[model samples]
Target: MSLPVHLVPALDGVVVGSTVTVEGDEAHHAVAVRRLRVGESVVLTDGAGTSVTAEVASTGKRVFTAVAADVRRVAAPAPAVVVVQALPKGDRGELAVEVLTEVGVARVVPWAAARSVAVWKGERAAKSLAKWRSTAREAAKQARRPWFPEVDELASTADVVAMLSTASLAVVLHEEASVPLASLALPADGPLVVVVGPEGGLTEEEVAAFTAAGASSVRLGAEVLRTSTAGVAAVAALLARTPRWG
Candidate 1:
């Protein structure tokens, strides 16, 4: 039978037959939120690809104990999918990060495109990036992801191009493009980076720069998608085509 899953980042390096105590946020979650009692079994994850099955030994207001019953190191999806998304205005960026995390993206790069409505600069940039990272962490836990995806700081179009150049395959989504995303043949291994432009889309010069860096322009479908939805759609399509999840 499948065991109950309870994601906790502090369970790293825990082995089967070892006894560990859950504290802080996790302790509160188990005792107050989940209302877990002694002798109940639950799965715990460290958000770094480590997972363990444990039985509750004791419960308290601030502390909880569990005896590890089994442990396994989960493998991440192959051909890591990285989403380079242009910053959208308002809460759109936050929504993008949360959905993409649930969609199993490996990394998120916040791009400051020329046509982007939202501009993250100075202290606002740092604070926004921190918020995105926190969102990613919480989303990963909610989705029960074995590994937490990273949320990078704001980057320029050129910086994004430089990073995508190192990947096995890099795709830039453009609605006006001739090539369809489904037509492209994905690599069996290595990394794939998908670049989604802002709501207004990329400038002619930005597209030229990415193409010059060996990034192929592809179209998702006939309908144009919002910046918040594009990355998640592309990731879902890629995952469906690849055997990474299997």
Candidate 2:
């Protein structure tokens, strides 16, 4: 449908065919940024699966109204891909999150690797998390994704291993590994978590820890990739191999 689209926080009990008012930031975006006019169509998403296609009925400074044309409930991709990325130096981590979000990753975890140059400690950790969260939200909107990927707080190797232990398939990217990522067969259902190390790569202890947690240490390719690039590349490869995204 040819309409200006925006995502908003969901209101309770709102359903298909219901006429509703768009308020707050979304309304401002529609009225100011998009310059939407009465009779123009727009799509409003709740970012929790529901997207409502509507035509604008009125527009004002504080509110905008629309008549719902259709509502669609989108199901998240199967075998949800979660990237546990080691915090890269400078803005590379931020860039990695943005790229992964665009690549349709379901969730992201910031890992503090043994050799990580960028550290997220104390209040800095909070700020970093917030930054990544904002990046994910913006990327989701720009990519027209119905749902937003979560940006988790910085975690240590042990913490990440514990988290991924619950996944159906958890793989750690290691340069020395002989098993190719494509060779590792993953379950069609359940989650897939890929842990990527820092520029210096994962320490021997970290690799052993992940392997002990049921994660297979797999090599991405013959050539080594940087910390930020590995997670996104591995995720894309996995997604292509999976039945759902393939």
Candidate 3:
């Protein structure tokens, strides 16, 4: 099995034979839950492209120390994929975030689309955003990703348009679109934006606005997919065409 990976703070300047401490709840989970013991190996990542392979050296009640055996730094994947996911009703939002992170999306931005069934307000908004962030973190760990995806604060349609306007390549998934996603040529570098509408789907105005801002409207296939899965499917299709997936 692959070594278990844990998220940690920055590991810059760390070298072989250096000792690093895994502490607090993270360490507790490793020692008490995973039962990580001395001499076993584990991977620790800063979630910003650096990872370390270490051998567990000692354990305490709420902390553990490891001797770093090797360190690796990965360049950020290109082109960076940013998914703008419309808020879905119920817990599907978390599901969407989890899958997008697992699929290697660089960032996931929750969009308040015109046809969204859910509303984020006050405490609910704060809680929902937190849940999405937490979901992304855990999903990244589960996927054994050294570079975790960022979950941005909820965005408005206008905000999304402005964001995509600056992207090197942008595509909006629409069931009504004539263009196929696979037919589009993805850029080798820079940002790639993918927009997935909510359960009720994107309004004509929203589609027009995004397209006007340089995003190409495209269809994944004949069958429609849930907002929770559409972004993941579209991203997989896009990545397969890029060297990032190879």
lDDT for 128 in candidate 1 is 91
C-alpha lDDT score of every prediction, in listed order: 0.88, 0.86, 0.94
Off by over 4 Å in 2: 1-3
For candidate 1, give the lDDT of residue 138: 79
TM-score of 2: 0.92
Ranking by TM-score: 3, 2, 1
| Tens digit per residue, CA lDDT, model 1, 97-193 | 9999999999999999999999898999998999899889878877878888988878888799899788898999999999999888988786899
Question: Which of candidates 1 and 3 reaches a greater TM-score?
Answer: 3
Each model's TM-score? 0.90, 0.92, 0.97
Count: clashes, candidate 1: 0
lDDT of 2 at 60: 98
Better of 1 and 2 by TM-score: 2
Off by over 4 Å in 1: 1-13
Which structure among the candidates has the greatest lDDT?
A: 3
